[model samples]
Target: MKLSIERAALLRAVARAQSVVERRNTIPILANVLIEAEGDEIKFRATDLDIEVVDNAPAKVERAGSSTVNAVTFHEIVRKLPDGALVSLTDDGASGRLNVEAGRSSFALATLPRQDFPVMATSEYDSTFTAPAPVLRRLFDKSKFAISTEETRYYLNGVYMHVADAEGRQVLRCVATDGHRLARIDAELPEGAEGMPGVIVPRKAVGELRKLLEDDEMKIEVSVSETKIRFATPEITLTSKVIDGTFPDYSRVIPQGNSRKLEVDASDFARAVDRVATVSSERSRAVKMQLDEDRLILSVNAPDAGNAEEELVVAYADEKLEIGFNAKYLLEIASQVDRENAVFLFNSSGDPTLMREGDDTSAVYVVMPMRV
Candidate 1:
């Protein structure tokens, strides 16, 4: 395969492909990226058995052929090249090496047979829909932080995407939880997405999808089947297998009858929690919230370390309540509030608390309380 591509274009394609390649591979070909050059374009494909990404870049093709090379090495070489320089890749098929040349620098990388690369098989999608980039971005970005890292409960390790009824209308929703906290975000359902089956998008796939959603004007084509999910754009395609398990019914986890209400500025609340937690025990990192009338006091006490306390004037009219929570969890949940005020609903000191941005029900968060 022989082709010449601009350094910027080459670097963009190779960097994306290399991210899908696993560093430690049991199979030799799995560590390499498949490069195919044909009329006016070159394609870079990489997979780690579960997730696959293919990136296309415009190139001047000298010959129509295909080759495989170490993805990490190719990316590093292209990244270090001078900007605007044209990069040439050539493989004679006779020699076991691929030649890379850019200006005065030249390097030869060992090549693997293109036939050895395992490509994920195509699936018959049950649902296909188009959605604006910003809409999809908000759905995933707001909920992915709560995805569970525990491997045993594989179902909880991904964001659940499905169509659900919200306020008497069907909406596209994404929900994620790690038992301690949960994030549920809703967006307008696109046309033809009414009957789509719910899919658990794995954590790695969610991270990679973020790159494609950076362009606000770009439109993303999403295809989903019982076992696979694919996100495609004009230049890039990402495909992954859905987690093979059922997500827990999260409705029960979100408290509904919480009577006490507290409205506080999200930024000020997060900062106060951060400062007070500084002197907390490393293992616990717990901060206590004492609410009385319109005053809220945040305090952290540790026997070995000094204690810290901060007070903020909030809007709380209900009876006094004291609750303890992990400082990290509170900071994370509070930061997700986009609006100036974050509303917290409490039932008791031990029950899970519900939080949302003002009165916006579109995005809601639930965090379990801990003992002080």
Candidate 2:
């Protein structure tokens, strides 16, 4: 394979491709990226057996061929080259090496046979639809924070994407929970998406999808099947296998009858919780919230490490209520609120608390209380 590509274009493609390659590899070829140069463009493909990413970049192709090289080493070499320099890659298929040259710097990396790389098999998608980048971004960004890190409950380690009935109309919804807190976000369902089967997108795949959603004006093509989900754009395509388990019923976890209401500035509430949590124990960073008529006080009491408290004037007309919650959970839930005021609906000191952005039902959060 012989091709010349600009440094900027080559760096962008290799950076994304290397991210999909796992650092520790039991199979030798799994750590390398397959490079194919043909038809005035070069394609970089990398996979970790479960997830695969292909990136295309325009280049000047002299001989149409393919080769495989270390993904991390290739990326680092291209990243250190001077801007605007032209990079050339050549493989003779005899020396077992891929030559990389840019200006005064030259490096030869060991190459593996392209036939050894495992490419993910294609699937017949059950449903395919297009949605705006911003719409898809909002659905995943707000809910991914609540994804579980525990490995035993593999079903809860991803965000659930499916069509849900909100009121009377069908909408696209994404929900994530970790047994401590939950995030549910909804968007208007796009055309041809009504028949799509619900799938649990793994946490690693969700992080990779965020890179494709940065363009505000671009539209993303999404394809879903029983076991795989694919997101594609003009320059990049990401394919991954979905979690092979059933997601638990989450509707019952969201409280519906919380009556007491308290409205407070989201930024102020988050900051006060952060400040008071400094004195609490690292194991259980609990902050107690004491709510009265038109007033809210946040306090943290640690017998060994002293105590801290902060008072904030809020809008609460209901009866008195006191609740305790983990400070980290409170901060994450409050940050999801984009609006000025965050509305909190409390059932009691023990029941789960519901929070939303100033009466907006599109995005809701639930956090379980902790005993102080």
Candidate 3:
């Protein structure tokens, strides 16, 4: 294939595909990007067995053909070329080499046959829908922090996306948990999603989809089947295999009857927990919170080291209570509360506690307690 493309356009196309190709895939073909030129368009495709991304950009097509080149090396070379320079890609079938030239810098990247590429077979998708970029963004952003790292429960390693009822209204929801903390978020249901199959998109897909959803107004077309899922924008399409496992029923962990409530400024609480946890050793850093009436004191005590306590005036009027939680967990969950205050509901010191945005019900988080 022979094609000439603007450096900026070339970088944009190859960057997406290269990001999908892992640096250390076991198969050689999986590390290369398939470049095809035809009808004034150049397409960059790359896959790592599970996820494949294709990018199409406008280019000057001198010859109509296809070739594969190392994704990372090509991306690096294209990145180094001066802004707005012209980049040409040329390939010869017999030599198995693709030449990339820009300005005085030129390199020949080894090529593999494009026929080796594994494309996802088309499926009669159970459902297809479109969602505003911000809606999808909020759905993933609020829940991804709680995705499990445990490899055994692979289903919990991704944000669980499905349709559910939230306060008598059909809502698109995303839930994730690691047995310690759980996050559940709801967005207005989009059309054509009544029969959608629940898919546990792997962690990498969540990340890649997030980068593409940065433009708030950009609408995304999502297609889902039992084995694979695809998300597309105007120029890019990403398809990946869903984890073939059952997601544990996450509803039980969401506490319903927790009565004790503590309302504190989210930023202030996160800051207090962060400052107190600084003294404790990494492995056993726990922050003890002593709550009484409207006054709260957060303190961390380590036997060999010193201690720290910070007092914050909050909205609490319950019986005296003392609870301890992992400082890391507290800081992370607290940071997620973007609004001014975070409302935490406790049911005894051992059972899981609940957190919500002030009094809002659309988003809620549950966190397990750790022994002090």
Candidate 4:
């Protein structure tokens, strides 16, 4: 195989492919990126058994062939090459090495037969739909932070994506929780996804998929089956196996009748919480909140460390309330509100609390309080 590709195009393709290649791989071929030069484009494919990503870039191909080269090593070499210098890759059938040449730099990298690459098998998707990149971005971005890191409850370690009715209309939804905090975000359902099956997208795949959604106007083609999910754009395709488990029914966890209302500027509340949490110890950073008619006081007290207190003017009309919560949890949930105020609903100090951006029900968060 022989091909010439511009430095920027080559680097972008290799960087996307190598993210799936683990630093320490048990299988030799898994450490390599499968490169194929054909027609007027080159394709770079990488996989880790569970997830696979393929990136396509335009190139000047003199000969049509394929080879597998170390993804990490090739990426490093291409990254160091001078800008605008054309990179040439060549492999002869008899030699076990691939030649990389650009400007005044040259290197011979070991190659594995392209036939050894483990390509994931394709399946018939029960549902396929197209969504704007910004819509999909909000669905995953607002919920992924709450995904659990616990291995035992593997079901909770991903975002549960499905179609559900919201405000008398069908909407696509993403829900994630770690038993302490829960995030639910909703987007308008696409035309062909009415019958889509619910699936749990693993944390790693969610992160990798995010990189593809930077363009707000791009439309992403999403395909899903019982066992697999695929997201594709014009130049890249990402496929992964969905987690095989049942997500707990989260509706029960969302508080229904919590009427105590507190409205505060999201930015102000976040800053106050952060300031008061400084005196908390590393072990169990807890911040106590005291609410009255129109004032809120955030305080933190740690026996080993010092104490801190901060006050903010808020809109609250319910009875006096005192609640304690994990400092990290409050900060995380607060950051979700963009330029709007964060409205919180409470039933009691021990009961789970609900927060949302202004009065919008499309994105809701529930956080369990900690003992002060």
3 or 4, greater by lDDT? 4
lDDT of 3 by residue, 264-312 (tens): 9999899889898888887348789999999999999987789899999
Off by over 4 Å in 2: 281-283
Q: Model 1 over residues 207-316: C-alpha lDDT tens digits? A: 99999999999999999999999999999999999999999999999999998999999999999898898886683578999999999999999878899899999999
lDDT of each: 0.94, 0.95, 0.88, 0.95
RMSD of 4: 0.9
Per-residue lDDT for 154-208 in model 4, tens only?
9998999999988799999999999999999999899999999999999999999
Tens-digit lDDT track of model 2 for 200-289: 999999999999999999999999999999999999999999999999899999999999999999999998888998997773678899
Error of 3 at 352 (Å): 0.5
Off by over 4 Å in 4: none
Candidate 1: lDDT over CA atoms?
0.94
Clashes of each: 0, 0, 0, 0
User: Of 1 and 3, which scores higher on TM-score?
Assistant: 1
Measured by TM-score, how close is model 1 to the native structure?
0.99
Q: 139 in model 2: Cα distance from truth in Å?
A: 0.7
Off by over 4 Å in 1: 281-284
